[model samples]
Target: MNTIAEHIADFLKEYPPFDNLTFQELSDIATNIRVINLEKHAVLFQINDLLHDSFYVVASGVINLTTIADAEETIINKCHEGDIFGLRPFFAKNNYMMTAKAREESIIYAIPIAVFRPFVANNSDVLNFLLENFAINSRHAKDNVNSNGKLISDTAFYVDQQSEMQYIQSLAYNNSPLTTESNSIIKDVAILMTESMVDNIVICEKNNPIGIVTNADLSSKIATGRYPITETIDKIMSSPVVTVIENVSLAEAQLLMLKNNVTHLCVTKDGTSKSAVKGIISEHDLIVAQASNPGVLIKEIKRSQLPKDLKQIRDRLSDLIQNSIQKNIPISHISNIASEINLAIIKRAVELSILDLGSPPARFAWLSIGSQGRKEQLLLTDQDSILIFEDVAPEKYREVKDYFLRLAKRTTSILEKVGYEYCPNGHMGSNMLWCKSLTDWTKQYNSWMNTPGENSNDLSSIFFDYEIVFGEPKIEEVIENVIFKNAVNNTLFFDFLGNDALKRNSPLSFFKKFIVEEEGPHKTKFDIKTRALMPLIDAARLLILNANIKGIKNTYLRFKQLAITDSKNAEIYLSCAEAFLTLSKFRTVEGLKNDDSGQYINLREMSKTDKEKLKNALTPMKDLEELIKSKFQLTQFS
Candidate 1:
């Protein structure tokens, strides 16, 4: 049999703070621990009780941490196995603010605060872990105080889960950056860059960054003999350096780098070239900041050469989605991150296909349509896309078309091998009907717009949401211009789309119960996609199209933009955005649990709170549908 101290040490080793300690350190602390057993309903500490000499770790059973409010007891949180409670003594001298009572027969370990204080004071990791836990739980308690048993808000969960990610936090950059004078010789500046083990050096004049020179500049300018080695650094430096303020976030920094197509950014006091340089942020710094899974996965996807390699990275994305949900990271954030990785995978897949098929016969743009295009695809679903190539000579059309068809076939095949299912309805670029020359695509859109009906409306809805995943931007731009010009004043098409938006009535029945499939494969299961999500998506698309809003594809974003442009119905638009996020998150969670599309939900198994949330989310639909009907004059059109 293990000694009491050994068993205590083993259990404590499984949890944080204690988990960071060595076994000997744990045993040393465990030796002085007190084990207490209590029956159900026993109170370990009540509100306003004097601070205990010890904090606690639940060994077995459950502890209810609660407070009395509004003349009634409100449970703030439940502390189960390996959960720590009664931590007030370590941080505060005041009496306990909440009461800890045994929810059932329980065993607890009370580690004397005197022994734990040493670890808190000495170990940064242990200190940070406790502080994070304490802050997260305290925030939860505050949110629960007004929640009335509702789950914690997404914002709160995001703070708790991503508190460590520091994506939005001010970047921790090198305060002392390497700099050189414009008068310095190229060879000397190059020597300085090499000696400092840095790739880039900023050229400063009067302590202000005027330009930057990187190793690429040296290789191209000096090594290539385009400029003499003795030339002034100014001759080779890239002028008008990209600048950002000290408080820029990791996300913002990465965006600036990508947008400017540069690897380094000059951090200045006032975010302009005239300001004094405070530091420099390189691509390396951003990579180190995101040294977590998402960054690593994106890097792997870009470097991956084979379909199987891409498939493994895609599988890791599922785990990332699951963990993000559990951490309560908002679905919008999760979807954005996942969508970026997915786009990279597709882009890389296209590159690999080109390696096999050689160069394209004509300039082309690969368009991702539907959910992936909307940047809302969380679950693995069918790839819906179209290929638009530049207009070719009529005589050479057959040869060019054949080449692109072969390319699309190879690319889609690789995508399938990477886990994206092929569209069953032949909506992919591999289909000749969907892939066409830019001029032909423009003609097709005009055909659909002039002839409004169920078929044309369905095709327009899918085709209008296309976002270019790769290739020539001009091809996609020409089609977009054609769409806006023809679609802006197209009343008949709007009416048809408005009617289609109302196709699924409401997700709820006359009695306000969820409408479920009565028969078929998903018998008695709610179709959230058709009912809850589609209504909002369709409404946003119709309204935005009518308003001539360009370049906004995501449904929630379309609604957000509508809120700005159509202020009269701003309240309804904002509510729809929130509702869409909540419903999308709900569906994503259900999908993750069952490993399938989160479309049809088994309402019978839903918890009371989830049902209430769903019902509340759907409430906005009535207002949105009314807004669409009023805006489109659907009654007269019908």
Candidate 2:
């Protein structure tokens, strides 16, 4: 007695987009669906086929999506029951880039795009799901595309619905916002605004927003005697309205607003004022879309008075990282956000310390070294920082040194309380050896560069990536100039750095098995940081320093720039960057899972897919190591 549509609706309801819809809506869509049954090896669609009016959902059995290159078919993904495919029509107007065939006897439900697009446009969750998956798939595909033109589709294998990466997620702004001509009377605009219930209106000239007038503008300029109510709207409007493109994320919008010191952002056709006005985003919109955005956390960090208050905010960062990883965000973007939050916490800690110690005797800068310096410290880690105060007179040296040391102690102590552990090697601002005047810091670098030794090389690895987190940047600039001068054409120092880099054994063995720790607490566990990540980091630093590249500190970024500077070995450098990002993501995920630093991984516990992914990520390390060996002439060192 069951209707076919009802039976189809019941099956479709178990999946997403459909699951998010009401049963009635699902049933309605089912009525328009065309159910097709196929025998094993039967093709549903082929590459270069014209766009279909409907996309598919596997109702039963398996569908293998593939692409052909060099006359060989490569399986891109396997879509099982409840899986969706052929979604290219939803996003693009092009013909199919892939072919979908039945791996076994299969039943597919083809849902009309006309019926599905409304749900996508109206529902945020459904739209986010599709966009997130498609974007992730496209990104990974792009990254893995080979010279032979075969596109690898690893990310398309799974759909993750765990957490919304709202910070990076495209904002949903008011597209049909109220607008008024700049020549319009202020009184007329006010009445039109009162009826429309909008707090602000874009003042336009030929559909392009020239300015914006908000409630504040009306109150400050018009409400006051400065501008009469009868005056033109342009008389009170804020000129050259801050604008963002349609795809601007909540975090970006917040930063743009903060940077420009405006409460609203005008969304334009081309991200400029010259383009057509598309929409507007107010601070209220950002607050509503808030899901652990860096801007919000940064505001909290600056406002926090006590270290404990900052700790509470710091603790929330792990969750942000977890969600971002779940959402498969690029590691670079995730690290940048984490770094901003980390810097803000450090800056705030310094502010609180300054408050406690009153005013400083001399100008000083707080330098973050190591992972924090490179802006890649995603998880809570050691505080590796140095304090460089301005050089003072010989008579005032003790007094100035004493003041900065006290300041360093106070700031580092606060950071420790906020969860960044004290550097075990004493590479901290609080350490008297690290906390020095600008002159001493310069002399220290010169000594290390002139005489390359074990201790100096170890220190070089950590300190060379130094970036100023707080205080006078001029102090850091002086130190940077000194380093670049000493670093240029310093073959001996680069060889030492290279020798340090090649110290770690390859992550894989002769049989391509993971070379894990053989003994101790981490026995049988793979050291991801030491074996996989450090080699890339070390190689990048050595090459960047050798190439005399300045300012780029992040390992992947260093490699990317090196690709440009050393085009002869560009492929190897690019692959190293890709591998580093993949490995970092694995480590971050493992760390988040185990609630630790994620340096070591228990290979036995990993899934087959995860192990394969990790293995694929490690493939470039061999090439990177060889490049270092030849470039640094490590054969002579050996």
Candidate 3:
């Protein structure tokens, strides 16, 4: 009885309809429910059947809501364990549009609809969940296969309704972004052109761009000395630069560029110069920002004028990682490049944070920790960073700490908006403890190392991977020197780190097929991070740390560095690096297709040929792990 109740509770916890029910309510419902077993191809419901007193849920096996489309049967949503169906259509006074069939052997529960309706009226959570599904399922003709027979493919709503995302910048009409102020001398304007490496600029007055000046203006007028270098910009500059409003489409912007024979245009608040210059768009800036490829995308990032612009730039960053992984680019190189971009973005964020606070009271450093520190971050993973400052007097300590704290908070916010999802547990530099002085960081490292205690594993996991990201580098180096002083040759430190590394076992099992998941949000899959990625990362970090190697955080780089130094074990280290790279590529391509973290992989999705490639890649990782176990005498520990 208890087992039955617990199963009901567990099922309730995973799903929306039952989530709000208390244990007693669930137990009472379960006690009253009637369970039935149905064989394959059994009919659960028929068309035009009056609504039953209860809702039917699949306890196990597949129940499909399928409809015919284009003379073919289409299954909309497959219902399995704990999946509740038949509630929405009937509750809304709709006749059963189709039939529900058992696609496989099934166990089902029928819960009285009367009991559920009262709860729906009272519970906002349940009502919202029901409404969201009702919206999707009802609008989708595909749901007809489940109950009302209808075709859904032609009318799947979300297929085109794009919501807000990191990318997708809408183009607007505007003035040429490049400009020369009317008060500036023509000579200074030419120098500005040369410095900016641009061929044209819009000459403007009172923040409203008037007319354009280009190489043509310089070639015909300045080089010929029609206007002397000392002459004011208005003497030779074209007056009244073309301007347009913010809702201009991409096509209009292009046509204007072509019609005026101008390479640059300034975007203004209004369609005319009566308003201030809002932005400038260049033909080259548009052409190069393909919004797809890495080479072009990086150019776009460099040209971005807003956080919104940077959002698009960051969106392409994932594509860059995905492509690099697909092409089997070294994860080490991939991580390094990604880390550089992330560092640049964070630096920009920190700069904004400073300005937002009026100004920084004193100088400080923003340190990149964990994956970013090692620079092996192939994905936009968790951001673990810390703040370090130059030591101030005792009386000013509180004042300085508050300033840095506020700055870290602002920087972290921009980072979140740019699509590195906020760390679930707040392991970021925004936390007060993480934003500290150089002395405090040194002390933190010292405490974790020498006085390793019960909670050492968690602390070591974070601090051991620290490296400087933004701000003063010398201060970080000072902290590094202090950490190594307490850490190297420390057996307890090595053991703790080693144990944590070993926790992520190799992906293989006794059967030799890669062990996959049974179930969760991503069930029946293998987590790349835990199995393939972690094993290599942990081994590299452990082996390098054991050798007293420092400064490098990226796994492949660490392995390569260690390989050069320890010629004896270099071959194995190199193999591990390659293995890591290969796995990263696999996960990357998989992620690009799905737009996810590129962690879990569906074994079924792999082609037979791809499976062979994966098997080959796994061999090096397996051997490396075995070698580590043997070298460290980890067998006994296991």
Candidate 4:
């Protein structure tokens, strides 16, 4: 009943660039499109050929873009369905730089550049998309220049220009530095440092810095009996202070420090000690200015006293994650650094919360469940936690529980203020169900594992991956021992969990295309968390529990351990580990871009390279599901 142009319009509207255009615009563009079908190994455009009047969008099959040099073809990139190619030459008005050929029997829709030019000029989003594509492809072409016979992965070629830009920006320094008279005695300077709460002070003469004294100087000189406390401060100070202009870049300041073999540099209006001292730049200051450095964030977290202070630090951490992803750093490495910072924040929150609620009545362990528990949390999501206290007397049970509930409430509130949203399902430690005594927690785990059902399986999945964020280490050990003892021998419970693991089917359809949401608010989008990540997580958890493994809570680590223990399926387990890392990296990048939970991914927004990478990562998931079905004997239950 519909014309071919209308059908093409329907499909085009589902993807970006066209998706950014209005319905009428899309219909007009579709009306002018010429659909061409090519056989396998057919050429679409050749190198050095005059540019065609139109560019192409692959509607089906794959196309390989390559260059012929030294009489051989070098593949630069592969374009799959919904991907655009040969667009750059149209814009540059130059001959085709590379040849585009159909890798398989394919159908492509060629749209005249003149018809698309209006949208590019009018729609900012469309223009940006085209520009980004051009920049990325240009970088790829440059990288392939020296690859004589080999292909370089895109991940290996991305350079971190952001860090270089930061290095060139003006460095920030401490303006109001502590100072003392040059003739002051060493003992007097020590007292001044104590009163001002400063580790270092500048020696001033007529409002100009002549030398500097630091805690290290005091320790190595005065405290070691090399100099007397009664000696003048200048006698112990490092004279002839190294100075740099206040406007110098961070890289320049660092170079000055290294060249002089000093840890501190005085900043002056001019680049010499003759000018007035405006500020002081220390090695520590340089470290802090590089906000993306995890070490700097950790130190800041430790020094923070208020919730607002931690909120600022968390905001900076988001920048760090973005920079790390841009540099193509390994996701596992990034997650570990982020997890450490997250733990530090929670620990600081607990310390401050105790001050608010008076001291705790008894010792209790704080557990971080869900993503934070597995050490995979990159962006802040909902807070899933539990509170376990040491057993109390029957008469004192109510009093103890009441005290911990107030403590949990204060801590969760502080964390929420610091950017971790409270769990939508009320699974936080503040909830009575999750806040319990040691004996009670043990009983909870036993009951959940022994009884196999929908509710128990749901609870088990959330609670089982927990790691202690605060309190006595032994409390965590005891709880984990209880879980392994109960779960290792529970056959019925394994079946329940295995069935739950397979609840979300593989993300690919019968034709090996993505099985995106068909309708509702998430139409044409994929739930990466539930479809790709959770299934892998659930599968790993079940496998680790069956093996009676303890102390490894992270999903990737669990798979690695499974591979080590069961060599029969080691290959599949290892592949799943790699797949999990890649998928997590993708989700984090998307989340950072949209400022959301990174749960729903719009397939239309992704580049062809990213889509292909995602599909490759998800391929192992189907194999993993098949393995679970055969190993757990889940065939009978479902």
RMSD of each: 24.4, 20.0, 28.1, 23.0
lDDT of candidate 3 vs native? 0.66
Per-model TM values vs. the true structure? 0.57, 0.59, 0.53, 0.58
lDDT of 4 by residue, 41-113 (tens): 9999887888788888878887777876578777767776777778643333347767889989999999997
Residue 550 CA displacement from its true place in model 4, Å: 0.9
lDDT of 1 by residue, 1-638 (tens): 24989999998888776878899989989899999998999999888899889888888988887777677887767777877778666544458777889999999999997787777656767765654454342334543342221212111122133322233334567788899899999989888889998888899999999999999999988899999999899999998899988876554565456445678999999999998999999888876765444556667787899999999988877876776676565677677777877898999988898889899999999999989889989998889889999999999999999988888888899999988999988889899988889888898888777777735634647777878999999988898888889887788888888887888657998899988898999999999998899888888888888999889999999999999999999999999999999999989988988988899888889999999999999998888877888887889533
Report the C-alpha lDDT of model 3 over 107-171, residue by residue, as the tens digit. 88887766565566456666545543433323233434334211121112222211101112234
lDDT of each: 0.80, 0.81, 0.66, 0.80
Off by over 4 Å in 4: 1-292, 454-460, 636-638
> Rank by lDDT, descending?
2, 1, 4, 3
Top candidate on TM-score is 2
Model 2, 1-638: lDDT tens per residue? 23999999998877776778889888888889999999999998888889788888888887777877579887766777787778766544458777888999999889998887777646767766665555333322334332221222222222221112344555667898889898899999999989999999998898898999998998899778898899999988999899888877654565456445689999999988888999999988876766454556777888999999999989888877776676567888788778878999999999999999899988999999999899989988789999999988999999888888898999999999999999899898888999999999998898788688745634657888888989999998898899899988888888788888988887899999999887899999999999999888888888888888889899989999999999999999898899889999989988888888899998889999999999998998778878888877788544
| Candidate 2: count of backbone clashes, pairs at least 3 residues apart or interchain | 0
TM-score attained by model 2: 0.59
Q: Residue 292, candidate 1: how far off, in angstroms?
A: 4.9
Once superposed on the true structure, which residue ranges of model 3 sit more than 4 Å away at CA? 1-306, 322-334, 630-636
Please name the candidate that would achieve the greatest lDDT relative to the true structure.
2
Runs in model 1 deviating more than 4 A are 1-292, 454-460, 636-638
Task: Give residue 497's error in model 4 in angstroms.
Answer: 0.8
